[model samples]
Every structure is written in structure tokens, then in C-alpha cells.
Target: MRSRVLGSVLFGLGILALVFAGGLAFVVAPAAARLPYDMERTQSVAEAPNAQFLQITNGVAKVDTGTLRSTVTVQPDAKTTADLEGDLDGSALVWLVGQEVVRTDTNEVVSAYSTSYAVDRQTAAARDWNGQWLDTGSNRQSVKYTGHMYKFPFGTEKKSYDIFDRDILKAQPARFVKTEEVGGLETYQFVQEITNGRQDLPKDRLDAILGQLMPGATSGSVAYANTRTVWVEPTTGQYIRVQEKQSKTLVGNTGQSVTLLDALFTYTDDTVAKSADAASANRQKLLLVGVWGPLALALLALLLIIAGAILVTRRAAPTTAPRHAHPRHAADEDETAPIR
Candidate 1:
């Protein structure tokens, strides 16, 4: 009876443990992705070596390039894409937007632009934010620019990814270069190159835009090339630090390439430090939810099953009843009367 009671108790506890683990995985843990996300980004710009003409005094060109301030925000959206149903087996959606305002040293806003993306809840992979479906193929390249920089469950070895380019509306290849430490957090280094990015602008329109950046510049068309290096934390897919060298080249009617805009940008030190803290915090949460929680529950269930089996086997096994001789006196009397 005691064994049965103990077995029942253990079995009940095991079921509860499994239920709790399932709840943590399916409900409680998933809410981590819905946290309000915002970041203040800054990029400092300077003239590249190839930049020439104008603001030249005594062989020193006075480049007026300064800083670009960008406000990036990611918010949980009420709407979700149909593909959201397939995101790591159903995930929430978020809307990410970034606006960059380029300012001169004198604090004049020279140019501004904005971009938006829809991203997976956990992995932050790109999706069709517009809710429009396309037959472009099952294995569509995803953008990893916002929410998270790299896909979740990052690999240890070198991996190449086709990152989506919003401006060009295509995917560009980014390859893992190495692993290093950024602000004390281990990171995976990735390099991406862009060449002749197609903006679909008309030749005249391209010329007009170039003219604004560089006076008296005549071009048949414009092309863009960029080399970006990013250090992303492997556990959290956070961008700890990033560097970009982008050049806008104008191709003359004569087929000559002229460098229009060449600038190098880096994330501020403060940004790197802040991201490291955030990554550390998130790593703890992931470990608890994805690793330790389930493991503990499984172990508890196994123990309960073992205990219950032991109790059941004990009850099922036959027990021998002690053998007893017939009463001596009764046996004597029966022996005498049995002769008849």
C-alpha cells in the first residue's frame, strides 16, 4: 500500500513537471521576443582616399562629411505574414524600421532615408512584411539586418548566408570570416561585399542625384559597392560591432568609373558595450528555457517512471504463503477413524 501511494505521488509530480516544461517552452519563453527594441545608432563619415576635387586648399581637400544619426526601432506588430506560421514552427512578428539622417560638420541635414522589415520572432529572419506572397521559390533568402543580425542557432564553423538587400530588393552573399571577442563577448565575424547594386534608377535620374553630391559631375549612370564587416555574438545574434566601407561610383558615358561617395562607418563604443550587456542577459534566459528547463523536466520524469516500475514489479511478483502442518491432535483422531 505504501509503495502504491509513493508511486502515485511520483507519477503525479512527473506529469505536472512535464506540463510546466511544456508551458515554459510554448508560452512563457516565447514572450521573450516581444520586448520593446530600440537602438540609437551613429555612423561617422570621412572622405575616402579615392575622393577627389572640390574643397581642396594647399593640397588638403576639406571634406565636409560628418556624422549620421540613425534611429532604429523594432516593435511587435498586430499583423503577421502567412509565413509566420512556418517560422521555427509558429512565431510572433515584429516590425523593424530605421531612419538615417546624414548631417554635415556644421549640423546640416544633407540626406535622409528610411527602411523597414518584417522579421521572425526568435530568429529575426526577414519575411514579406507587406503581407504579399510571391512564388519566387521556397528557399528565399532572408534579410538579417534588423531585430537580430544573424539567424538563431548559429553554427560554430564558417557559414555563408545570402542576406537580403532592401534597397536592391535582392540577396547578397555574406561569409563568415572568423571568430573573435568583441567587448568581452565572443563573436562571429562576417564579411559581405556588394558590387554594382542595382537601384533601378534611370540614367538621368542617377546623374541628377550624383550632381547633388558632387557639383559639375556628369555620369551615364551610378553604381554602388560596399564592404561590410560585422562582429556578432553567437549566442544572441547581436551585433557587437560593425564596420562598413561603401563607395558610390559613377560610370561616365565614356565607360570610366568615378568615385562619388566613399565613406567608412563604425558603431560607437557605447553601442558595443550596451549590446554586450544585452547579449549576456539574453544568453542566460535562453539557457534556462531551452537547455536547463527541459533537461530537468525529463530527468524528473525518468526518475518517476523508474520508481513506479519498481513498485509495480514488487506488487506483481507472487509471494509464497508459509506452509503449516495440520493440528497434531486432529491428525491423531483422524488416523484412527479413517480405517473404516
Candidate 2:
């Protein structure tokens, strides 16, 4: 009975410990993932400016890890342009310009071009733009344009002032599908389509448009299929979210493609402008999923420890006698022993 009682107590303790451990693990697993998420979020916020408009003049690009090392200046000005000097690799310079995009190497202008617009500051619609470049030494010029907007509420427009033969505008249609919580805030998701190789757009015109758009939508890898997603903050109208994805080739080697899955943009509004804490809170929630794994493991370990403790206590429990006891007779033993 004593052993049983002890065992029961130990068992209960063990169960409690196990429960505690499980809870701890559950909490820790998510916490670990959050470490990376938080780091990324903090880095992104730090790299980006808090004002309505931001400008990065003479921006320096780090080779690996894709972190912005330094910027010439940042302010709340509406129109901002920056001259970027870096080694040409894929699409790395797309995030710096709003009007004209120029690619230079070793202090020499390799290509000078402009982007056409499909949508303006206000009014939700689909917009496309192309890129046009001029040959400084030789008066030669090239233009590249790509496909029509298959999606709805989309339109195309172009502005050309140079001596280029053709005008190319990057054609992308933006539609306000719905409001979603992205990076922890309610954001409007916009879908943008680019000219796939299967479609027929003038190669020169397509190239020109891509050139203009490339600075804003930089590619991650050399493989053409890797595309980046850009989001504009609905309240501030400033880009807040940028995501990149890897693409797999379905057919021939040259038939590779990159599809934009998700992009987020935020606009300046009273909420974002008035409170800095709110913005931080939103970022934390969106990144919470990354830390859940560590929290779960910690909880599991705690549970096991609790179970072991309960078993140990059960083994250590002392035996106890019953309240009632029967008396033994020595005389009966003596009588029985006489025969022996």
C-alpha cells in the first residue's frame, strides 16, 4: 500500500513535470525561429527610412549578404535620385530610382534609359513601362517592350523625350485585390505580370522596359527564373515588402521562368505616421512564425524530465502498515514444533 501510494505520488509529479516540459518546449521552439525573423525584420527596418519619401545618393552595395553598407543621404523629399556604382551582377540596382535609371560601370555610363508608366500616383490601374538606352560614343539606341496586360483594370502609357527610335515602357498591371496582413500590418496585395518568353513582345522594346524596371525589382540569382516581389504601403505609398522566390524550369533549359507570388507595399497614413510603436508591433507579429520551432522542443524536454521525476518518487515511497492487525500465537507454534 505504501509503495503504491508512493508510486502514485511520484507518477503524479512525473506527469506534472512532463506537462511543464512540454509547455516549455512549445514556447521555446517558436522563440528560436523568431530569432531569425526578428533579426531580418530589424535589419529591414533599419535599412529603410521612416519618412514618407527616402533617397539614397551614392549608395554602396555589399557583395554578399545583400545588406546596404552606406548611403549618401536620406530625407523626406518627394523626388529622389541616387547614383549607384557597383559590379554588374544580375538585377541588383532596381531599388534606387523613380524617374530615370542609369547603369554605370567604373565611372563610365554604360547605359542610360527611362521607364514608362502604366499607373500613376493615384487611381488603381494596370501600368506598363519600357526601357530605352543611348550609345554615348555612337548615336545608336535600342528599345525593348513586352506583352499586353492580361489582367483587369490595367492600362499602358509611355513618355519619350530622347532621340531613341522606339519608346519602351515596363508594362505591369496593379489591381487592389484585397487587404491582407503582411509583415504585420494590413496591406493591399497587387499582382504584376511580366512578359514570359512564350509571349511575343518586341525583344528590343521588352529589353528596354525590363531595364527600367530592373532597378526596382532586382533579381536574386543569375537564373532568369528568380524574380523579386515589391510591395507598396497603401497608407504611405512607399514600398515596404520585397520578397524573392526560386523558380523551377518546366521544359527546355532556355524555357526557364520566374513567377511573382507575393509582394507588399505600404502607403503613408495617420496611423503609421503618428505612432512608431504600432509599426514595430506589426512587424513582430508577422515574423512570429519563424520562432515557433525552438519553443516546441523546449516544451518536450521539460515533459520528459517531469515524467522521470515522478517515477523516481514512486520508487522511493515507503511501505505503510494497515490500521488493523491480527495477533499471532506462540503457543500454536510450540505445539506444531513438538512434532518436529
Residue 20 local lDDT, model 1: 80
TM-scores of all models?
0.64, 0.25
Candidate 1 C-alpha lDDT tens digits along 1-340: 7787777787777787888878777776666543233323323222223322223234333344445443333344444333455442244444534333344344433334444455555555665444422111122333334223334333223676566554455667779999898888889898889986854444555655455545555656657777878777776666677776866666665556556456676666776787778778877886688668877887887788777767755654457986667646765857667644
**What lDDT tens digits, residue by residue, belong to model 2 across residues 218-298?**
222221222334344443333345433322221222333333111122223432342334344533443343234334544
Report model 2's TM-score to 2 decimal places. Answer: 0.25
Q: For model 2, how big is the CA root-mean-square deviation?
A: 20.0
**C-alpha positional error of residue 132 in candidate 1 after TM-score superposition, expressed in Å:** 9.2
Distance (Å) between predicted and true CA of 76, model 1? Answer: 4.8
Best-matching candidate per TM-score: 1
> How accurate locally is residue 274 in candidate 2, as Cα lDDT from 0 to 100?
28
Q: Which candidate comes out best when scored by lDDT?
A: 1
Give the CA lDDT, 0 to 100, for residue 263 in model 2: 19
